[model samples]
Target chain A: MRDKFNEQLEQLNVELIKMGALCEEAISAAAKALLEGDAALRETAAAAEREIDQKERDIESLCMKLLLQQQPVARDLRTISAALKMISDMERIGDQASDIAEITRDIEDSPVVSHVPIAEMARSTIGMVTDSIDSFVRKNLGLAQEVIRKDDEIDRMFLDVKDELIRRIGQGDSGETCMDLLMIAKYFERIGDHACNIAEWVEYSLTGQHGDM
Target chain B: MRDKFNEQLEQLNVELIKMGALCEEAISAAAKALLEGDAALRETAAAAEREIDQKERDIESLCMKLLLQQQPVARDLRTISAALKMISDMERIGDQASDIAEITRDIEDSPVVSHVPIAEMARSTIGMVTDSIDSFVRKNLGLAQEVIRKDDEIDRMFLDVKDELIRRIGQGDSGETCMDLLMIAKYFERIGDHACNIAEWVEYSLTGQHGDM
Candidate 1:
């Protein structure tokens, strides 16, 4: 029975890794779509979002089955609970990426990446998402902490983007354009937040406490 | 053993209702602070947010204990899992409300409620939060669906707020003020989304499936 439980646990890990990869794909595609003004890439990101949603349901069922069959305790219980929390964050990442894609599609005529370091912010956020999942899969405490630390950079970049947009608005740029760009930047900031949440859950699963304890 | 589990489940319900009340308080306080330019109310919202966070940790520990000790199956398992999901949404509602209060603090000199129907939006959103939790506590499917449907109104209000902000920006209003108001509106919109999530979880807990089968 113990062997079977361990095997199921390994399967849960595999599912989580797959969901994380899909989230990365979704966010990266949304970023590329925004930067390049590529409507096709927006569609790709939307598809990835749908896939991620399906994966969430699958992984949720798997976790439920493990809990029911094995009734895991202590560290094992924490691991499953953390997985449950992590997937919600992952699912939100997917939704936010889709939201970004929607914004990119709205602004297909005039991409907003030229005036701000939005592409850089996107890359940074994507890295945080990837590293947070890696920390979870490997139980790497250092990597998890690093992901948490990266959120400050993401927050700073969002403010920089806001400042630049304000300057452009003052210079008589289209208000609608500036607003769209700000919304996109906000979406990236939120993606960073979800990544931070996943990293915190990873920490909680490992240490049974979250953040700076 | 079954009676003991049921009693603990009732305790969980009571705690959830309490957390939900805190969220409503936080959002309403933040809204009042914004509308009235009342710094004191902002502080109240922030305090409520801290309380909500503590409640989340306490409830999470309870859920973990219930899962590990009872190993509840079928409907019982679903109830616990739904609680897990609901608390995350409720916690997010608290965070978003606090975020609104932070924006209120930043714009104490020039309140943003004059040009938009922000007060109405706040009232509607607070209603949704209240009804969502009431549904969870009472297991009222009808109320849960009503809360979900009410999200459409909140979304429309957010768009209206955005359009008004854009118009203000076009008329050479302080971009900073307009941006801050837009952010505040977005936060309210997100709080509504969280309420919708809690309502869905309430449905899932009672019905074992989420949304139109």
Candidate 2:
């Protein structure tokens, strides 16, 4: 019975890693859609969002089964509970990515996009999302802490995006377009936040310390 | 043993209702601060947010204790798991309210505030938050469904806010100030989304159905 429980726990880790990869794909496709101004990638992001949602349901059912069948305690209980919480954050990341794609699909050629370092922000958030999951899979507290720390960099980048958009508007750029860019930048900032949340849950699972930012 | 478990579950419900009330206080205070241009109310909202956070921690610990001590099955287990998930959305509602207040405290005499129906939007979101919690307490699936439907109203209000901001920008309003107002409206919109999430969790707790929106 103990061996069977361990096997199920291993399966949980594999499912979480797969869900994290889907989030990365969704966000990356959304970012590329914005940077390249390709409406096609929006569909890619949307498809990934659907897949992520399905994965959330599947994993949630699995977690419920584990808890019911094993009645896990201590460390095992914490791990499963943390997984339940972490999936919500992962699902939100997918939604934010889809939202970014929605905005990108409607936007035309806007010069505001070039002035902001949105691509760099996207890359950093993607790294944070990936590393947060890796920390969970490997049970590495230090990597989870690093993921939490990296949120500051994303916040700083959001401020930069805001400042540049303000400058462009002051220079008589289209306010409508700048607002669209602002919304996109805001979505990316939110994705970073959700990634930070996932890392916090990872910390909670490993250390039983619920760290709030 | 079962009697003690039921008592603890009752306590969990009490704590959840208290946390929900704090979220309501935070959002209401934030809306009043924005409408009245009262920086003092920002501190009020911040205080409520702090209380909400503390309540989350306390309730979370209670939940862990219940799970470990009773090893609840079936409906009892679903109730505890749902409580675990609902708190996160409630906590986010508190954070978004504080965020709105933060933006409101910074702005000085903006004409866009009059143009947008922000006050009405605030009232609607406040209603949704209240109803969502009431549904959870009553386990009324219909009330929870109503809360989810109300999110559409909030979304419509957000578009109105966006359009008004765009019109003001065309008339040469300060782009920076309009951006600030937009962020505040977005925060309200996000609060509505979180309320919808809470209602969904309430439905799940009662019916064992995870309805994604």
Candidate 3:
């Protein structure tokens, strides 16, 4: 019985990693679609978003089963609970990616996007997402802390993007296009936040210390 | 022992209601601050945000203790787990309130804000937050479903706000002010989403049915 419980714990880890991969795929596709104006990549991002949502449901059920059947305690309980929390953030990241894709579908690309550092922002946020999940899979406290710290940079980039967009608007650039780009930038910043949240859960699982607390 | 568990469950309910109250206060203060351009209300919102964050930590610890000591299963376990999930969304509502307040602090009252339906959006979102918590407190599945349905209207208001702001920008209104207004509107929409999430958790606790599923 103990061995089977351990096996189930391992299964939880595998499923979380898979869900993380789906989030990465979704965001990457959405960002690429934004930078390149590629319709195919937008569809890829949307498809991955759907897959991410399904993965959340599946992983949530697995965690619930483990919690109910095994009645895990202490560290085991923490791990499973942390998975429950992490999946919510991961699901939000998928939604943000989809929201970004939706915007791209609604409007054509404007030169205003090239004026801001949005592509760099996306790359940095994607890095945080990748590192955050890696920290969870490896149970690395240092990497988890690093991901948390990286969020400040994303926040700063968002402000910079906001200021630049405001400047473009002042210059009488296409107001709608600037609005869309700002929304896209905001979504990227939000995705960074979810990645930061995932890392915090990793910290909680490993050290029993919630970042906010 | 079962009697003690029942008392603790009641305690959990009380704490959730308290946290919900704090979230409502934060958002309402922020909205009032934006409309009146009142610095005092912004400070009030900030204080509520701090309290909301502390409340999250306190409630999280309480839930963990209940789960660990009681090892609850079935419906009891579901209720406790649902509370755990609900607090995260509640905490995010606090953050959105803070974000809205921050934007108001950065800019003066603009005439453009008066032109948009932002006040209506804020009112609708605050109502959703209140009802979402009320549903959880009462375990009213109908109220929870109502909150979920209301999210669609919030989404529609957001697009309306976007279009109106875009038109203002096109008319050579203050670009920076319009951008700030748009961000504030988006934050309101996000709070509505968080409220919707809390209601969904209420549904899950009551009926074992996740809204997304």
- Tens digits of per-residue lDDT for model 1, A121-206: 88999899989999988999999999999999999999999999899889988787888888889999999999999999999999
Per-prediction count of colliding residue pairs? 0, 0, 0
**CAPRI level of candidate 1:** medium
Candidate 3: tens digits of C-alpha lDDT, residues A139-176: 89999999999999999999899888888888888888
Query: How much is the lDDT of residue B116 in candidate 3?
Result: 87
Q: Which of 1 and 2 is the better model by DockQ? A: 1
Candidate order by DockQ, decreasing, is 1, 2, 3
Each model's lDDT: 0.89, 0.89, 0.88
Instruction: Tell me the spans in candidate 3 whose CA falls farther than 4 Å from its real position.
Output: A69-74, B71-73
Instruction: Please report how far candidate 1 places residue B123 from its true position, in Å.
Output: 0.6
Candidate 3, pairs of clashing residues: none
Each model's DockQ? 0.68, 0.57, 0.55
- Candidate 2 lDDT tens digits, B167-186: 88888888888998888888
Summarize candidate 2's per-residue lDDT along A10-57 as a digit string, tens digits.
999999999999999999999999999888899999999999999998
Question: TM-score of every model?
Answer: 0.97, 0.95, 0.94
TM-score of chain A of 3: 0.97
Q: After TM-score superposition, what is the CA distance of residue A118 in candidate 1 from its true location, in Å?
A: 1.1
**Winner of 1 and 3 under DockQ:** 1
Better of 2 and 3 by TM-score: 2
